[model samples]
Target: MQATDNVTLDNCADEPIHIPGSIQPHGALLAFDIDGALQAWSDNAPQLLDLTLALGAPLASLPLPAEVHAIAAECRDLIEDGEAPAIALEVAIGTHQFDCIVHAYAARIIIEFELREVPSDAVAAFALKAHAAIDRFKRQKSIDSLLQLATEQVRAITGFDRVMAYRFHQDDSGDVTAESLRDELEPYLGRRYPASDIPAQARRLYIINTLRLIADINYRPSPLVGRAGAAPLDLSHSVLRSVSPVHIEYLQNMGVGASMSVSIVVNGRLWGLLACHHMTALQVPYSIRMAADVMAQVIASIVQSIEARERALMAEQSAAVRTRVMETLLHHDEPARALLQHAPALCLSLQAEALVVAQYGKLMVHGDIDLALAERMVASLPQSGDEIIERSALGDWPEELRDALAPWAGMLALRFDPSTSGWLLALRREQINTIRWAGRPDKIVRVGPLGPRLTPRGSFDEWRETVRGRAVPWDATARLAAGQLLGEMHRASVARHVETDRARSQLLAMLGHDLRGPLHSINMAATVLQHGGAAGTMSTRIQASSGRMERLISQVLDMSRLNGGLSLGLEKNLVDLVPALQDLLDESRIASPGLRIVADLPPALPLMMDSDRMMQVVSNLVSNARHHGAQGEAIEVTLAERGDTVVLEVRNVAPPIGAEMVANLYSPLKHTSVGNVHNRGGLGLGLYIAQQIVHQHGGEIAYRYEEPQVVFAVSLPRN
Candidate 1:
């Protein structure tokens, strides 16, 4: 019989165990290895055992070694009956006893004693220590420092040989940035491994199985299939464990004897791995491995903080640099060429040896380089609007740039604009190796009698290779700043262009207004002379010329006002469409007596529109059709209401507008020189101006080509 005071059980492996009623029961199981420390069992173990005993059957005490198996079997039956009890098992090493208790639910295990009972304060202190560790991790701010500190903490807790913070690159390669190694072991810090070494399939497996353990990479298989009562673990949860067999094989191939890795997740994505490796064959019990995983949680938070700080700093610096460049460029009042000439010295602070300016698809300014070489560099650049850089051999000159200085050794080219053949800036770095080889014996003969002629240490070929086949020296942040500066420069250029255009338009408007008064006076005087005098040939000719001059003045004034952004005042009224059409027809008949004119106006069609602008729109279309149509052909004006708009159309019977003319008729300065087959007389601004006026009144003008005739139509909003 076991001594009641000593509470010792030895070789009692097969004996029935009794729990003291004085100890409060909680559903938790604890296991301790004789060679190591204690391990906590799942909280559900006690409840499972209680349910097993409540099924109207006497409980049998299993031997110590077979306790786990017996409890699993009983729990399975209790789970089926829906009344599993929580159980706590404490394996005592010194006493050679296994203490067991059953509870209906999970609660603290308090072993109450009268005089010298189990130390309750010591157990509570252990719990507090674990909670404090987690709290310290939660309060960390810097990710780099957090990772470094966490690795040290985990190493101290678990006694692992080397702990590392491994990060995955964009290409799936992995890098070890931080590591904590024992004093005896050499460091494997700042090492990068290729993605191919891991393979794509293995990475996918790692993400699925969050935590993995290769207890002994060289350990022979136990050949025990399906350890009993092993619940299926969902590794996707924050606290779950699953190991992949393939990873074990990989570690073995890498000559690693033992390995453990935990996934570091950020924003729901697998960020990297927290890996520990041991060269000598070793095994970390499940409890210590869990502690390492908990520490990894703290490391993840620290990394995120560091990355956020770095990104914020880079953005702030880029903004500051861009602001400085814009202020410097806009400080001067000069042409783009003068500004760029001083820009390299001012903006780059003379860091660059040379500067070049390209404008209107030509090299306008260059410094410290021959014009031919400058042109060649510009030609090699891409024609796209965005800035670009290129590298090429200096000796092989294309036909377009044959005369440049003896081949360029190295060069950097930037294109400002491709549309107007704008400027290209080129900076040349001459080849020095070629100069040193000119007189050396190594250049002339292969065999040298004088212990080999002097040879140059650094060659142009070496320098060229260093700079070639690589992106521009600027980083992403610097390039972004440069792009912002270019945008400001382009805006200044565009502003200058707008101001110039406005000034020219204003001048033309004033000239047209001044000419209109004199031309109107001439027309009035001519009309009086033609009626008061004998209506002679000279009198008639003067009147016709005066009328033409008046028309020209009116066109110029109207174009000026339109370009000046004069608004059209629209007075809405219900006006019958027939009378307007009849009035236009009478004017057209008087203007050309020999031409046949027809009016098909609907009496009930009424429109709400600016009447004056509408009349001008109709007159422009009718006159254009008549002028372009054949002699003696009938010109038809039609009006009707369709849907929500009133439609007015003027059709002429004449030769069809040629395909080329039809496509470009409304474009300004589109002069067609097709001999007698094409007639090009006006500035091509009439239809454009007419379209604008019609659009201003909420109407649209369109043209259709019908065989032997062309129709111009205007649609206005209806009342």
Candidate 2:
């Protein structure tokens, strides 16, 4: 009896064999019918046994035919006596050899059998083997061991020339990462195939289906009922069905007569394919192929785990390297050069060849390049503060230099400095064999005479060439390491900036303390002379000189406070504006007896303001008018109120304020007319400070020029 004939059996004593839909319930038993007549029934029986063992099912307790009744009884007694199930089993009244699997709860058994003529001993051996394999698979732990053991088991059961673990890329490309083959077979490690070979549509179809078995490349395809246009290439449903003729032809072109592929899914996504290939025409029973598929699934999980672990480890190492780099550079006395020297070592440790730090048109530092070529190379590159890669011919480099570099080789450039040193270039050379072409030869070259082109062959060469020199550009691992190093450098820079800011603040504090005392004394002495008038002529001279010195000191203090971001205090009070103006006039008249003074004050004008600061503001304005106004010309002071504020105006009959001077009238250092006045000689801090003080009280100060007369006014808030 052949496995293929078992599909038509209709013996149902309790319940018809439940053929499940696409979604199988948990713990549901799956049934499959094997195909193909065997040369020796005994030889083929062991294959069925292998399938049972792999699926974790005991075979002895299954129903048997009359011819095998004696053996079935013996096996049944063994099971009733608490013995584990065996491989050889009976199904459908002695016509079929079947493997039976009990549910986890041992409540029922799902029997899988074939209608092929098989040796009685061979069937019994298969039962035992199937039980043992299932037990081991169930006990397996860890993804790697499960995959390795599963692959080996499948290969042994299927007798394929080569069994390979095929992982898929993000772009749908596939690569053979692991392989199991006979001793005489060649290794296909790290071989990559383009996504085009399978086509996008085929890959999409594969994702939904799990197993595909091509018994013979020369066999004609049998289309499924209602399947139109092309015959269905998938055979998970039609056991023993022929493959599509087109696919068979396609395989024949590739020199393969038979092939079986099983999808390895991870987290419900098709992660890769487990492929079995045979050089000669071959037929695999559905039972054996299905078992292989299960084994492939286990291997897929292990591959995924290995990939995840590798990525996680790399990320952790990168972070640690970055931290160390930053600490070493930022703490160094000379950070710039220290960072440069450390860059190469970091790159080397990370397995990279060169480190480049570029800012705008400047190359701050470069490592691992010939000294003779470095200067020329740096100069030829464009000055840009952008992060980008520089492939052999893709960047602003001399043609000669570009020619010297390899194809499919380039550097990974990142922005380290946001403003100036915006690019950090880390060079890397991919392995030749790993290079791929996507029809854009200009974009990615595999091989050329200029150096190494990035054509398919050249790309593959770079991928396979693992030796240091064989890698034209550098090493990818090194580039990543350099990237980690740059992160560290940035951290160091930030720390140094913080420290420098602290030191600058401290220096400003010390300077402010040392200058405050002398400034206060000069201001006091000037005030005393204006009030006491001890040595008539000498006192007047001392008072005027001290007043000038005091102005200089006040300017310094105000400038310092402004730069230090200190806020001014405004103490407002209701005061008679007339008295304040009169006092300022009196002081001014005494200081400059040679100048005429005129006062126009309304008797009862009250202003809400900081009186002391207001008095200082008035004094400064009046003194400035006296000094800079036409010598001996009368200086007019007027007090008035409009709206919610009082205005005090000092009109001087001096040279009209120049356009340039008016623009910078309150600037401390650039007070042109005021600084030029001999009696008002200082850093021109008076007007600037007066403006600041007036603003602090929520008032404004303005200067107006009317050809022959220049008027300076201050408006303060009202009571």
Candidate 3:
């Protein structure tokens, strides 16, 4: 199957190139149906195969050699078994031997013949050369060194004028990454070729064929002779198949007579090529070609091994960075602020030109980044996706934002938190390159023997072009590093929150326990003063202050227990809630005489609940309203039954809570303020404790601001 997307041969001459209905003059092709009847034969087949045959001629009827007949029979059986076999062997006809390649494709059997002129020791020589190359490959440490070694080995093995290890870029362009050429020849090393040089269709063919050889660019293409009305022969698998005329012209323009390309496929994708060019027509025997194929496979495996090791090393380094950053974040109360100090290190580790961290409505940038641009980039990020969004080319970005990105050509943004609008963005600067093309990359339309069509450029001299607006494309390693850092950041944030909460809970528990003794002694002294008939205003004030202190300590201890994941120790009973509300309101009114409070209660409503805990809930809510409500406004408490549930609403006239504060409204120890409504007094735990108490009773507590009134509604099931 052909590869798709950007490399598709659709609407192009690639499809026609696959079945060109011809073969090169240096070889001959004969195609047969599954039943061994001659379907097609190249015009040169008679001269190369030493046969006098016509279309529809049976293999047994033809005057071909017996070896050809035996190979055809073997191929037929394999084809019948649904196995496409590419078998190569030596065959002799009229005292002349030729290399015969046979393969089956789509129920058709193709036999290709090439003249073999190698010495008797050719195989032995190739084996020694290949073994030495393999040894050198094993000793190479880096990919560049391996590629250079491969080029040298291939050039020595093939005897080509120039051997280049060409690498394909993200944009399909190619660079001569490593080269081995004759000393007197001009070096094409380090030269770049536009993607158009090898059209998408040709690249596809390279992947399927793996080895392509053009023995002579000047060789005439002998058309296949077949029935006039029959479909053209499919020579996609023909070893002696004729190549595209445009490519032949392309090589001729560069003054190249012979060329061969061995594809370097990594992980099943065409990665690059070991391209060999000779100044004169040259034919490499099948043995040498097979040896080259083995070398290419070895090179591909080594490339994969090297890349995998590099990725593993990157993962190890990224993990170390994550640990250091996470520890720093956990140590500081303000994680975002702490992260800013390590942004430079993070940017370096990510191989980024700059790094921007957006957290809790703030932007912190490291390296050469404009603050305003960073802010705009943060705003451009999607608010909700957890997946990393990356683009290596600035052209892939929105046109409006492209200019603003300026020197930066790539952006990688990831939003780690779904609840907050923040992102971790890594930027890469433009790699502005000066490309030296082997020829002018532009293809022109001109009249040729094939007719008016796209023709190859006539120039082969170095054509220099400046390329910009691209970066040293981000790879999987960068993505992995970014993801790892964000994951650790998330984990560390949770850990820090837990640690802070734990420490606060511990302090409150200790303070509450220590104050109990002093509070109890004060209460006892007040009681003695009252009993001695000397209880004056001073004694009354002392008793009231001590009582308030005792209530505050009790709330602190309760909040501490709740924060520590301990459940409330409640005593249950089937009791009426009206009396409890009334008693709580009476006490609240007595305690805060200046503050007006009112209640709307049903006379008798009984439920299965902890009556003391129920009183605590009501008292906490009432206390919250009294503390946070608008001055001179009355606190309204309503207890009503609604079908299967009872709703207790503590409504007070207060300013609306800010949206930001509302998220943490029921959180313990949060000091929330909106406009004039300040959250002051009493440890900020009343609403939180009330919420937990309601939850333990299989009920829910909710808060909403309705115009001038803030409502805290507690709903419980009426069993």
Candidate 4:
């Protein structure tokens, strides 16, 4: 007899569920040595098996079949073959038919005998039914529907009052995902059970057993007694191993008299359970249990195949956005702006509310987020690892980051490199979460005579609570996609550096050839002037050559500084623009004698600007007009002030640029040779440098072709 007074809430966790010290009365258990002599037997075995000998008696003394020993040896070999040492087979002994199970554990061989027999016709029926169930599983299109079909099939085969397909969560707790039940039974679908209901040791046993059955919850437990000095039987592999008393009480509380469970394994790990319960004592034949077990194995194999296929589809979709971003970076020089062009894919596919992508100390924020919070979060992450750090709740963040991370609670961050400070952080907001538990799990203990005892809760009441400062968990699929993104981004970053190196080499090659001409001309002209040969003509020639050399030197210096990411310092002041325009026009007329130049500005149009930088910007555009604009067309510069803003439009009638070629037109060192000598093979930095200056002054420069002209407009704030 067991004493209920000894069980306490604090000690319940230590309960030896693996070794219950007995077996259920519906089945007979026996433990024997290598010599095939019975060394231990359940108290009911004598009557159940009708044995005629004492303990340690050879099995040949009783009416045992020859096939039992041969099959028992084969069952024992399962242990060495990395399989469970358990096999179910039917046997007949002296007019009594029984379903027998043989299992080997350590030094002992344990066998269980149940009063069961399948008719010849029933054997054919069981095989057909199992095949039909597998066919239904194949027809299911989704995991949800497949599991539902599994539960329904098991219920139909076993005649249980209720059957549920329960799936385990990352926390080890389980939820009833799908279910089938008799009309009289209450539904258990969508209910969640705490992990404590099944202890760690119990779960390990599940991996070994795969399936469990309790024929009569009300049956008395039968103790296994060995010879006087023989050790107690280890029933870990026994089919008739008695269950925990607490679990019995729990089932009894739920008005369940019997239960069965089949393990659903995927990729060699236990994923969930096919749980069946009956409102009354239910005796299931061994053949029926075998059918259910086969169905569970089928579900495991199919589930793995389906999940892999789904992951492949998601990877392809995510690749589309990543590929586009990579292509842009390859052709352009800006990674931040390039990534922003595909912000929708980055956020929507990852199920994130916002994303902050940082590379090489530059950060680009996308979607909904407090910029300050995002910056702090990315800055706080370690810069020495490529690990994906996840914070499901912001409250758990460091004190310095918590306030900044307000409103948004979850983050999934991926660093491109550990030794460098670059990252991709995905943010999620807190959700008003709702969960359905089987009962108030916190209130599961009751006051006992000794102390508090752990027991099942009396009532399963609807419990609702508000959840805050937590975001939806980062699921497996999302993390997998992040990993793929990390690899693709790494490859793209490497490719970008290679492209930059190639472009720089090409620029050096062009500069070498372009500088040779001016230097040779200067040398020849200097010799003539120094030798007193026609001083006026030679001096003019030397002066023009020197000026051309100076311009080339200045352009090279500016391009180098811009490519190296140096700042363009600007000093702003309110100035009249008409005079500045007149001076630049004078220079453009002298520099290009072929093109026409004109300026249209309000007489008193004044605005705050960096005069030197604005002059540099206009000079580049004018130089480009002389070199690239049509020969006979006028380059028009118009200045118009509206309220507090100003627009500077530079337009020239010329051939329209093709749509495909416009993006590359902004790239530095990209140009076409002019027909004549003055501007042949000019480094394509005039428009590029002009764009940089306009952007620095909090203004935009855009280009468009309209009919017979190309327009470049600069919109600047006139404060």
Q: What TM-score, computed on C-alpha atoms, does each candidate reach? A: 0.39, 0.44, 0.68, 0.83
Model 4 poorest ten-residue lDDT run: 672-681
Q: Quantify how close model 4 is to the true structure by its C-alpha RMSD in Å.
A: 4.8
Ranking by TM-score: 4, 3, 2, 1
Candidate 1 Cα errors over 4 Å, as ranges: 1-147, 205-209, 219-246, 267-271, 280-291, 325-381, 385-500, 503-719
Question: Best candidate, TM-score-wise?
Answer: 4
lDDT of each structure?
Answer: 0.51, 0.54, 0.79, 0.76
lDDT of 3: 0.79
Candidate 4: residue 126 lDDT (0-100): 68
lDDT by residue for model 3 over 542-630, one digit each (tens)? 67656767776787788767644456877778998888878888888888888788888888999989998888888878877887788
Using lDDT, rank the candidates from best to worst.
Answer: 3, 4, 2, 1
Q: How does residue 110 of candidate 4 score in lDDT? A: 78
Q: Candidate 2, TM-score vs. the true structure?
A: 0.44
Q: Report the number of clashing residue pairs per model.
A: 20, 46, 0, 3
Q: Per-residue lDDT for 58 in model 4? A: 74
Q: Quick one: how many clashes does candidate 2 have? A: 46
The RMSD of every model to the true structure, in order and in angstroms, is 25.2, 22.8, 17.5, 4.8
lDDT of 1 by residue, 108-169 (tens): 11110011123434434444554566677777776656666666665655456888877776
